[model samples]
Target: MSTPILEFATDANNPCMHCGVCCTHFRISFYWAEADDAPSGWVPASLTEPLNPWLRCMKGTNGKTRRCIALTGTVGQAVRCAIYSQRPSPCREFPVYLEDGRPNPKCNELRAQVGLPPLPELPIAPANDPDGTPTEPPTEPPAAA
Candidate 1:
Protein backbone atom coordinates (compact mmCIF):
# COMPACT_ATOMS: atom_id res chain seq x y z
CA MET A 1 0.00 0.00 0.00
CA SER A 2 1.22 3.49 -0.84
CA THR A 3 1.87 5.89 2.02
CA PRO A 4 0.51 9.42 2.10
CA ILE A 5 3.16 11.99 1.16
CA LEU A 6 3.24 15.77 1.50
CA GLU A 7 5.40 16.25 -1.62
CA PHE A 8 6.68 19.77 -1.00
CA ALA A 9 3.65 20.59 1.04
CA THR A 10 4.59 21.90 4.48
CA ASP A 11 3.01 19.89 7.23
CA ALA A 12 1.42 21.71 10.17
CA ASN A 13 1.58 18.61 12.34
CA ASN A 14 5.09 17.44 11.47
CA PRO A 15 6.55 20.65 10.17
CA CYS A 16 9.79 20.18 8.29
CA MET A 17 12.44 22.85 8.49
CA HIS A 18 13.53 21.80 5.01
CA CYS A 19 16.63 20.40 6.71
CA GLY A 20 17.69 18.63 3.51
CA VAL A 21 19.46 16.04 5.63
CA CYS A 22 17.48 13.20 4.11
CA CYS A 23 18.45 14.31 0.64
CA THR A 24 22.11 13.84 1.51
CA HIS A 25 21.68 10.91 3.84
CA PHE A 26 20.78 8.11 1.46
CA ARG A 27 20.61 6.93 -2.13
CA ILE A 28 17.35 7.60 -3.89
CA SER A 29 16.65 4.89 -6.41
CA PHE A 30 13.37 4.16 -8.09
CA TYR A 31 11.91 2.08 -10.89
CA TRP A 32 12.80 3.31 -14.39
CA ALA A 33 9.14 3.72 -15.31
CA GLU A 34 8.95 6.79 -13.09
CA ALA A 35 11.13 8.80 -15.42
CA ASP A 36 9.60 11.21 -17.91
CA ASP A 37 10.79 9.17 -20.90
CA ALA A 38 8.66 6.26 -19.81
CA PRO A 39 4.92 5.95 -20.25
CA SER A 40 2.91 7.87 -17.64
CA GLY A 41 6.15 8.90 -15.94
CA TRP A 42 6.66 12.20 -14.15
CA VAL A 43 10.23 12.39 -12.83
CA PRO A 44 12.44 14.52 -15.00
CA ALA A 45 14.32 12.27 -17.39
CA SER A 46 17.33 14.57 -17.51
CA LEU A 47 17.79 14.54 -13.76
CA THR A 48 18.11 10.78 -13.44
CA GLU A 49 20.86 8.26 -14.11
CA PRO A 50 20.45 4.58 -14.81
CA LEU A 51 21.31 2.35 -11.87
CA ASN A 52 20.64 -0.89 -13.67
CA PRO A 53 18.46 -2.17 -16.49
CA TRP A 54 15.32 -1.45 -14.48
CA LEU A 55 16.35 1.08 -11.87
CA ARG A 56 17.25 4.76 -11.94
CA CYS A 57 18.49 7.19 -9.33
CA MET A 58 18.58 10.93 -9.01
CA LYS A 59 21.94 12.42 -9.91
CA GLY A 60 24.24 13.75 -7.16
CA THR A 61 22.57 11.22 -4.82
CA ASN A 62 24.40 8.32 -6.45
CA GLY A 63 27.77 9.90 -5.81
CA LYS A 64 29.62 10.25 -2.52
CA THR A 65 27.99 13.60 -1.63
CA ARG A 66 24.52 12.03 -1.61
CA ARG A 67 22.82 15.40 -2.14
CA CYS A 68 20.01 15.38 -4.71
CA ILE A 69 20.20 17.60 -7.77
CA ALA A 70 16.59 18.60 -7.25
CA LEU A 71 17.23 19.97 -3.79
CA THR A 72 17.94 23.68 -3.48
CA GLY A 73 18.26 25.99 -0.51
CA THR A 74 20.18 26.02 2.75
CA VAL A 75 19.81 22.75 4.54
CA GLY A 76 18.24 23.04 8.02
CA GLN A 77 17.09 26.55 7.19
CA ALA A 78 15.21 26.59 3.88
CA VAL A 79 15.10 24.03 1.09
CA ARG A 80 12.83 22.57 -1.57
CA CYS A 81 12.66 19.94 -4.24
CA ALA A 82 13.36 21.33 -7.71
CA ILE A 83 10.96 18.81 -9.21
CA TYR A 84 8.40 18.39 -6.50
CA SER A 85 5.47 17.46 -8.71
CA GLN A 86 7.48 15.33 -11.09
CA ARG A 87 9.74 13.68 -8.54
CA PRO A 88 10.12 9.89 -8.50
CA SER A 89 8.42 7.43 -6.17
CA PRO A 90 11.37 7.51 -3.79
CA CYS A 91 10.80 11.20 -3.27
CA ARG A 92 7.03 11.11 -3.18
CA GLU A 93 6.98 7.97 -1.05
CA PHE A 94 9.39 9.26 1.60
CA PRO A 95 7.41 9.51 4.77
CA VAL A 96 7.52 11.93 7.68
CA TYR A 97 4.81 9.89 9.28
CA LEU A 98 3.45 6.38 9.56
CA GLU A 99 0.05 4.98 8.55
CA ASP A 100 -1.42 5.84 11.93
CA GLY A 101 -0.16 9.45 11.93
CA ARG A 102 2.90 8.92 14.12
CA PRO A 103 6.30 10.26 13.20
CA ASN A 104 8.66 7.87 11.39
CA PRO A 105 11.75 7.07 13.43
CA LYS A 106 14.09 6.89 10.46
CA CYS A 107 13.33 10.38 9.24
CA ASN A 108 14.42 11.73 12.61
CA GLU A 109 17.74 9.92 12.42
CA LEU A 110 18.78 11.80 9.29
CA ARG A 111 17.70 15.10 10.78
CA ALA A 112 19.73 14.45 13.91
CA GLN A 113 22.81 13.64 11.85
CA VAL A 114 22.67 17.21 10.55
CA GLY A 115 22.14 18.69 14.02
CA LEU A 116 18.45 19.14 13.36
CA PRO A 117 15.70 18.02 15.71
CA PRO A 118 13.49 14.98 15.52
CA LEU A 119 9.85 15.24 14.53
CA PRO A 120 7.61 14.98 17.55
CA GLU A 121 5.55 11.85 17.90
CA LEU A 122 1.83 12.34 17.68
CA PRO A 123 -0.62 11.86 20.48
CA ILE A 124 -1.53 8.26 21.09
CA ALA A 125 -4.47 6.88 19.16
CA PRO A 126 -7.43 5.45 21.00
CA ALA A 127 -6.22 2.47 23.02
CA ASN A 128 -8.72 0.18 21.31
CA ASP A 129 -7.23 0.69 17.89
CA PRO A 130 -4.05 -1.07 16.82
CA ASP A 131 -2.43 2.32 16.28
CA GLY A 132 -3.46 3.47 19.73
CA THR A 133 -0.36 2.17 21.43
CA PRO A 134 0.94 4.81 23.86
CA THR A 135 4.47 6.12 23.57
CA GLU A 136 4.94 6.23 27.30
CA PRO A 137 4.62 3.18 29.47
CA PRO A 138 1.41 2.75 31.44
CA THR A 139 1.65 4.03 35.00
CA GLU A 140 0.96 1.84 37.99
CA PRO A 141 -2.02 2.71 40.10
CA PRO A 142 -1.23 4.47 43.36
CA ALA A 143 -0.26 1.89 45.95
CA ALA A 144 -2.62 1.74 48.90
CA ALA A 145 -1.01 2.89 52.23
Candidate 2:
Protein backbone atom coordinates (compact mmCIF):
# COMPACT_ATOMS: atom_id res chain seq x y z
CA MET A 1 0.00 0.00 0.00
CA SER A 2 1.57 3.25 -1.13
CA THR A 3 1.14 6.31 1.03
CA PRO A 4 -1.15 8.78 -0.71
CA ILE A 5 0.19 12.26 -1.21
CA LEU A 6 -3.40 13.52 -1.29
CA GLU A 7 -4.09 17.02 -2.59
CA PHE A 8 -1.09 19.23 -2.96
CA ALA A 9 -1.11 22.30 -0.77
CA THR A 10 -0.89 25.65 -2.59
CA ASP A 11 2.32 26.30 -0.72
CA ALA A 12 3.48 22.74 -1.35
CA ASN A 13 6.60 22.44 -3.39
CA ASN A 14 6.38 20.62 -6.72
CA PRO A 15 6.76 16.86 -6.27
CA CYS A 16 8.53 16.78 -9.59
CA MET A 17 11.60 18.51 -8.32
CA HIS A 18 14.75 16.67 -9.45
CA CYS A 19 12.63 14.39 -11.61
CA GLY A 20 13.08 14.87 -15.35
CA VAL A 21 11.97 11.45 -16.57
CA CYS A 22 9.07 12.74 -18.64
CA CYS A 23 11.20 15.38 -20.29
CA THR A 24 13.72 12.82 -21.45
CA HIS A 25 11.40 9.89 -22.15
CA PHE A 26 8.55 11.38 -24.16
CA ARG A 27 8.45 12.52 -27.81
CA ILE A 28 6.88 15.93 -26.95
CA SER A 29 5.25 16.80 -30.25
CA PHE A 30 2.79 19.62 -30.84
CA TYR A 31 1.05 21.71 -33.54
CA TRP A 32 3.17 24.02 -35.64
CA ALA A 33 1.12 27.03 -34.59
CA GLU A 34 2.48 26.77 -31.05
CA ALA A 35 5.79 27.90 -32.41
CA ASP A 36 4.32 30.16 -35.08
CA ASP A 37 2.36 32.37 -32.67
CA ALA A 38 4.75 32.27 -29.73
CA PRO A 39 6.66 35.44 -28.83
CA SER A 40 10.34 35.82 -29.57
CA GLY A 41 12.76 34.03 -27.20
CA TRP A 42 10.05 31.54 -26.34
CA VAL A 43 10.00 28.16 -28.09
CA PRO A 44 12.93 28.77 -30.36
CA ALA A 45 13.10 27.34 -33.89
CA SER A 46 16.50 25.87 -33.17
CA LEU A 47 15.15 23.47 -30.55
CA THR A 48 12.44 22.02 -32.75
CA GLU A 49 12.15 20.02 -35.94
CA PRO A 50 9.10 19.46 -38.14
CA LEU A 51 7.11 16.43 -37.12
CA ASN A 52 5.25 16.99 -40.35
CA PRO A 53 4.57 20.23 -42.16
CA TRP A 54 1.62 20.73 -39.84
CA LEU A 55 3.42 19.70 -36.65
CA ARG A 56 6.55 20.63 -34.78
CA CYS A 57 8.45 18.66 -32.15
CA MET A 58 11.43 18.91 -29.84
CA LYS A 59 14.81 17.98 -31.14
CA GLY A 60 16.99 15.27 -29.52
CA THR A 61 13.76 13.25 -29.21
CA ASN A 62 14.29 11.37 -32.45
CA GLY A 63 17.09 9.17 -31.19
CA LYS A 64 16.64 5.92 -29.26
CA THR A 65 17.20 7.40 -25.78
CA ARG A 66 14.85 10.33 -26.54
CA ARG A 67 16.02 13.20 -24.35
CA CYS A 68 14.53 16.65 -24.97
CA ILE A 69 16.88 19.41 -26.07
CA ALA A 70 15.36 21.69 -23.46
CA LEU A 71 16.39 19.45 -20.55
CA THR A 72 19.25 20.72 -18.42
CA GLY A 73 21.06 19.29 -15.41
CA THR A 74 21.01 15.71 -14.09
CA VAL A 75 18.04 13.38 -13.84
CA GLY A 76 16.90 12.45 -10.27
CA GLN A 77 19.16 15.07 -8.73
CA ALA A 78 18.59 18.47 -10.33
CA VAL A 79 16.91 19.24 -13.64
CA ARG A 80 14.65 21.69 -15.42
CA CYS A 81 13.09 22.48 -18.75
CA ALA A 82 15.00 25.16 -20.62
CA ILE A 83 11.83 26.47 -22.26
CA TYR A 84 9.30 25.53 -19.56
CA SER A 85 7.32 28.77 -19.95
CA GLN A 86 7.22 28.41 -23.73
CA ARG A 87 7.04 24.62 -23.88
CA PRO A 88 4.62 23.06 -26.33
CA SER A 89 1.10 22.22 -25.21
CA PRO A 90 1.84 18.51 -24.94
CA CYS A 91 4.76 19.05 -22.64
CA ARG A 92 2.82 21.57 -20.61
CA GLU A 93 -0.12 19.19 -20.31
CA PHE A 94 1.69 16.08 -19.19
CA PRO A 95 0.53 14.54 -15.89
CA VAL A 96 2.82 14.41 -12.85
CA TYR A 97 0.62 13.12 -10.06
CA LEU A 98 -1.96 10.39 -9.55
CA GLU A 99 -5.52 11.34 -8.70
CA ASP A 100 -8.78 9.58 -7.71
CA GLY A 101 -8.27 6.03 -9.00
CA ARG A 102 -5.43 4.20 -10.71
CA PRO A 103 -1.92 5.45 -11.30
CA ASN A 104 -0.40 6.44 -14.65
CA PRO A 105 1.75 3.61 -16.02
CA LYS A 106 4.06 5.81 -18.04
CA CYS A 107 4.60 8.10 -15.12
CA ASN A 108 5.30 5.07 -12.95
CA GLU A 109 7.71 3.59 -15.46
CA LEU A 110 9.63 6.81 -15.70
CA ARG A 111 9.68 7.14 -11.94
CA ALA A 112 11.16 3.68 -11.67
CA GLN A 113 13.87 4.58 -14.18
CA VAL A 114 14.86 7.38 -11.86
CA GLY A 115 14.49 5.12 -8.79
CA LEU A 116 11.45 6.92 -7.37
CA PRO A 117 8.61 5.04 -5.71
CA PRO A 118 5.29 4.53 -7.51
CA LEU A 119 2.63 7.18 -6.91
CA PRO A 120 -0.22 6.33 -4.55
CA GLU A 121 -3.93 6.09 -5.46
CA LEU A 122 -6.31 9.06 -5.56
CA PRO A 123 -7.20 8.88 -1.83
CA ILE A 124 -10.78 9.92 -2.59
CA ALA A 125 -13.93 8.49 -0.99
CA PRO A 126 -15.27 5.34 -2.65
CA ALA A 127 -18.39 7.18 -3.75
CA ASN A 128 -16.30 9.64 -5.65
CA ASP A 129 -14.90 6.87 -7.80
CA PRO A 130 -17.55 5.35 -10.02
CA ASP A 131 -15.23 2.45 -10.75
CA GLY A 132 -13.14 2.99 -7.64
CA THR A 133 -10.03 3.64 -9.65
CA PRO A 134 -7.63 6.56 -9.23
CA THR A 135 -6.77 9.05 -11.98
CA GLU A 136 -4.06 11.70 -12.39
CA PRO A 137 -3.66 15.45 -12.50
CA PRO A 138 -1.53 17.80 -14.59
CA THR A 139 2.03 18.38 -13.48
CA GLU A 140 2.32 22.13 -13.66
CA PRO A 141 0.22 25.21 -13.16
CA PRO A 142 -1.90 26.12 -16.18
CA ALA A 143 -0.52 28.79 -18.42
CA ALA A 144 -2.44 32.04 -18.42
CA ALA A 145 -4.36 32.86 -21.54
Predictions in order: lDDT: 0.65, 0.63
Q: How well is each residue in 1-145 modelled by candidate 1, as lDDT tens digits?
A: 0133422222322244346677777788999999989998888989999999999998988877778888888876666677876877876677776655556788768777766666654445343356666453113211211
Candidate 1, superposed: residue stretches over 4 Å from native = 1-14, 124-145
Which candidate number has the best TM-score? 1
Q: How many residue pairs clash in each candidate?
A: 0, 8
Clashing pairs in 2: 99-122, 99-135, 100-134, 101-133, 101-134, 101-135, 102-133, 102-134
Q: Candidate 2, residues 15-128: lDDT per residue as tens digits?
A: 455467787877877777777455532567778888897887889887788888988888765666777667877775666544444566777788788786665445453555
* Top candidate by lDDT: 1
Worst lDDT 10-window in candidate 1: 136-145
Q: How accurate is candidate 2 locally (lDDT)?
A: 0.63
